[model samples]
Target: MTRHDPALSTPAQSALDALRANVAVPFERARAMPKAVYTSPEFAEAEARHIFAAEWLCAGRADALPNPGDYLTMQIAGEPVIILRDREGVLRGMSNVCRHRMSTLLEGRGNVRSIVCPYHAWTYNLDGSLRGAPAMARNEGFCKDDVTLPTVRVADWLGWIMVTLNPDAPNPADQLAGVERLVGHLPMRDYREVFREEFRWNTNWKVLAENFMESYHLPVCHAGTIGGASDLNQMECPEGEAAFNYHWIIKNDLVPLALAHPSNTVLQGDDRRITWLLAIYPALLVTLTPGYFWYLCLTPDGPGAVNVLFGGGMSADWCADPKADQHFAAVKALLDDVNVEDKGCVERVWKGLCAGMSGPGSLSHLERPNYDFARYIAGRMP
Candidate 1:
């Protein structure tokens, strides 16, 4: 008789084994990821340490912080970090915790000349150097030059602001080179960020991420919003690389803003109608069309919740059009509806997983991106 060792069969360990099993087969024989991969707290903790803390995470669009002093703060696997443009107009990332007392320095997205700790009135320059402290004049051998917030790794890839706590993490540009080769003609770096919002959802981060990666759910779940527009047969999902997965669709002109602007002569033929769905490793999901782009940067709150930084805007061609304002208004309204539909679908999936009887089934051919995504997740597990 086979004996099960309790020490070797933890919830997290069992989930890891299931994930390995799921990704072991080729796409033709693959199945959906097991429920424990999304519902187990222990597994979530392991992911937090091995993936979120170790990978480069998208903070938001670098264009959103165009002006000096504009800054945004985020927490990656419980580490508070700040991304900002300093006085010299340099993009930087640094620890957001105060040097003296460890209080969180900044709250959210805003423009700040300097970071000031509310607990003790200790101030830091936009470059993260110490500017002042309220009562440290008489301290023994204390020099302001020696005091500064620790710098975190920050990179501007295309237009996205990427932050990482891992000092040895690979350059964002190098890692996403495949994505640039596929969408380089779209001028993604110049796309103006028109809107950004952060919200928490009552679902696992991977559940929402997998939902975005595959269009198979569009016809059913997003029927009220974008379902009728999505043709599964038109999507082209090639094999994914180590860093990202992308599938492109030749879109119809149902939404005018989804096609290239008349002035965008650079895009011709089918290129003008191509919409690329890019899933950057770990948690950046982007929907890039010729005229506009939108993205979601996900951070796990726990096994049952995800914190999202959602934003998007018009391409340079669209932004320069005479009817830019009117076009953006329509596109924004459509995005809001699409988001509503997605929220409903993914939340229900999470709820079903919680019922404890849910089991993964055979993956459809349309779910190729999901299979690649599952492989990415499984590869991240140590």
Candidate 2:
């Protein structure tokens, strides 16, 4: 008879055991993960500590902080962070907690000459050094120069800003090496930021990441917009690399914006006809088409919720066209409609997971990206 150990039987442990079982199955016969992995608070906490906190997470577009004093504040794995361009035009990341009372020093994005604590009015320079303390003069041996905001590692890759709370985490640029060779033909570096928006969804962060990584649902979920343009059978998910998972689908028809622009001779043959979607494990989801690219940076709010930062922009060549504005408006409308459809679908999936009426379901052959995603998560969990 097999013996069960009570020492390894917490809710998080059970969830991880189930997850390992699910991912252990062969790819051709794999089953979906247990709903507990998505609905258990204990499991979520484990992921927050083991995956999100230790991974290099996408924060936002570098263009958003174009000026030296520009800054954006966000929370990563429940830890508040500030990403900013300093006085010398260098980008930096640091804890947003005030050095004095530990209150949050920043709230949203804007240009700030200095970070001032709202609680007790402690001020910090753009580089995170203490500038002034309103009432610390009374304390003996107090050295303002010794105080500074805790610095977080930051990297700018392909126009996106990525931050890591783990000081020892590998730079995103290093992990994403050769990515430029894959999509370098697309004028990404020159693509200007159009707009950025955030959406709160009632679904696990993994669900959203998996949803974006595969093209299986495009024909049904995104039927009205990008669906008809893609051939579901033609979608191909190749073996994923250690850093990310990606798939490609040939478009039946060029998107309106792409059709309007002159062919980017740099992109040969099928490159002009294919769309690639990549998920940088744990959070960043990117979609690259012939004429433009967009991304979602997924962050878990808890076990059953996610906050997504959605943004995109036109290729520099396309943006140079005289009718670019009208074309972009059309693209934006289609994306908005698609997002609405996805929100409903994922939320319904979450509801189903919560109901507990279903067991692990078989995956479609096209869900290879998701299979890899499961393996990635399983490998990370304790």
Candidate 3:
């Protein structure tokens, strides 16, 4: 006989473990994944494989690597990769690790006409081709071609740069081909990360993703900001399109397009009744409105620590204004409230489990949005 945990009941735990193997389903209509999925080290390792390794994850902006020789380096899904504008002005990527002695090639982002391994000084072109191997050649049959800084596959879509651990991985667009058509019409090229900051929050990255999937906290966490600026009572799930339970928060006069379902805050204003957020799989939250975007934390730096990255997606007016600073500050305050609400809940959950409080948590019958996220992750698992 098995001792059953309600939160980890056969049904809930089974479904959640399913997500550990696959993707999630919508909650309520589907089933919530188990708490262990969020807290387990094994689950994190699996995610690095099935999800991040296989999927097309966002690295940064194409504009960030504007000029030839300019490069940006980051670790994604545990791969130390570098993105660079080649000497030919082409965007490219290479393993940051040196092919020779395993020391990192580039220490940081800068304009380097060529990439060189700091160790033993093995050099490579901006294109990731080896240029020189200082002393290894005379020591052994060290051919540069076989030892070029192991380049990863790269593709630039719109203005975003994407890198894959797979050497011959299919294009990110192919994986997201469905997404492009679903929410493609919005002009995203003009928008930029106007505000950016990342901090370590002790919680699973999925908690950050889950927190952004619904507006349940608006009435409490951000009542002052969202309640006053937008309506919380009139929010509903958009009909027709199959939402994976992850979507963007739309605000008043602030929304620039016609959304399938209008959140109450926007219903009070004209031209602001609709905005759409494309919740790209594996934890990318983007709010696409005219001028700029409001965003949620990606939390991709391992599942334990969520790194908040968002800010202005300004339209022409916001970009050209002298008050851009004020606008950013306002966004920060508003986001701060939402973060406080979410962080409080997530931290409590983490602490509870640490204190052995793994009990079944309630899901609001009305919180369909949160359910969607639960389902999505559940489906992703096995």
Candidate 4:
């Protein structure tokens, strides 16, 4: 699709060009992406089109909609999307816009017998087929059977609901196969989502994603909570793949939450003491610890803003413990504190980009994730 935003003028194009050039450099020689990439509306538009629109993005947990007709609606890649469990217990995704007048069909989350448009009441079945349309009998050529909500591709990968607007987008399950084996010890299917929150940050989406993918800033940015127990030197960042990137950090002490439950004998050696942070390219950020798992689904609002849905859960084994309630409260508090720290740091970074006083900075050996992330962005851009 062609983007005609005035923001795509000469200066924005120049900045994007520079960023693409910088990303092409070898990781050892590469500097950070140009500030414009985080401050330019044109570049953000490009990303929405090339990356978000074309990729399979994690929306939320499939378990959230356990029964048939349960549905959730959200905007993905700037388009409204509806995810629902059909009568056959199959998960489906479709455009939320009513085909008649283009009005949105649903809001938030709920169980609905049929998707009835608020404006004209153009009704659709749970499977997205046109069911009823008021006052259409007089229209000679109108055929309800010929109309249906446009289907968006949908997949459930390890219990997470993933959707894609691109008709030909690769299957998320195929791309994320490695993740299953990586965290197979955790009962991902049984880990119910116990908490969820949405936050809007005045920073580029990439800034938040890269921030979560690396451990280099933990000692300084998250000094009060997790940082206190972390040793940056102990981090192990493996080379990133085309679909995802990950790193592991060993905890100095056993996490209290993990200790409250029996250890999964399936975990070997230092795996019990390790925390893994993974980024599924484009926007999904996942953290897997022995005690719990959390994910942040990032969506770019524009060059200077992002919308985030953060959700997490305790492992099935941990949730079965007698002290699960107390432990959950503590874990939630820790997550809240970490969120505050990350917000402050990324907002400051956005301000730095706005100042326009400095160019891209060199990447630290510890920031390999950022290096790979930059290249991923560059590869998606024009």
lDDT of each: 0.89, 0.84, 0.60, 0.84
Ranking by TM-score: 1, 2, 4, 3
Candidate topping lDDT:
1
RMSD of each: 2.5, 2.3, 6.0, 3.0
Quote the lDDT for 356 in model 3.
67
Error of 2 at 345 (Å): 0.2
Candidate 4 local accuracy as lDDT? 0.84
**TM-score to true structure, per model:** 0.96, 0.95, 0.79, 0.94
Question: Per-residue lDDT of 318-377 in model 4, one digit per residue for the tens?
Answer: 888798888888888889999999999999988888884767789888889888888788
Q: Per-residue lDDT of 212-257 in model 3, one digit per residue for the tens? A: 6656665766665554544556555542123334344455553232
1 against 4, candidate with superior lDDT: 1
Clashing residue pairs in candidate 1, if any?
none
> Among all windows of ten consecutive residues in candidate 2, which has the lowest summed lDDT?
1-10
**In model 4, where do residues sit more than 4 Å from their true spots?**
1-12, 258-260
Error of 4 at 352 (Å): 0.7
- Stretches of candidate 3 off by over 4 Å are 1-31, 167-170, 177-185, 239-250, 253-273, 296-303, 308-312, 321-326, 336-341, 353-355, 365-369
The residue-by-residue lDDT of candidate 1 on 1-382, one tens digit each, is 2223344338888898888888888899999999999999988988988899999999999988989999999999999999999988889999999989789989898999889999998999998899998788899888999999999999988889999999999898898898888899888998999999999999999999999888888888878877888688877778888998888878888888999998777889999998999999899999999999999999999999999999999998899999988998998999999999899989999999999678889988888889988998887777
- What is the TM-score (0 to 1) of candidate 3? 0.79
Q: Give the Å shift of residue 352 in candidate 1.
A: 0.7
Report how far residue 192 has shifted in candidate 1, in Å: 0.9
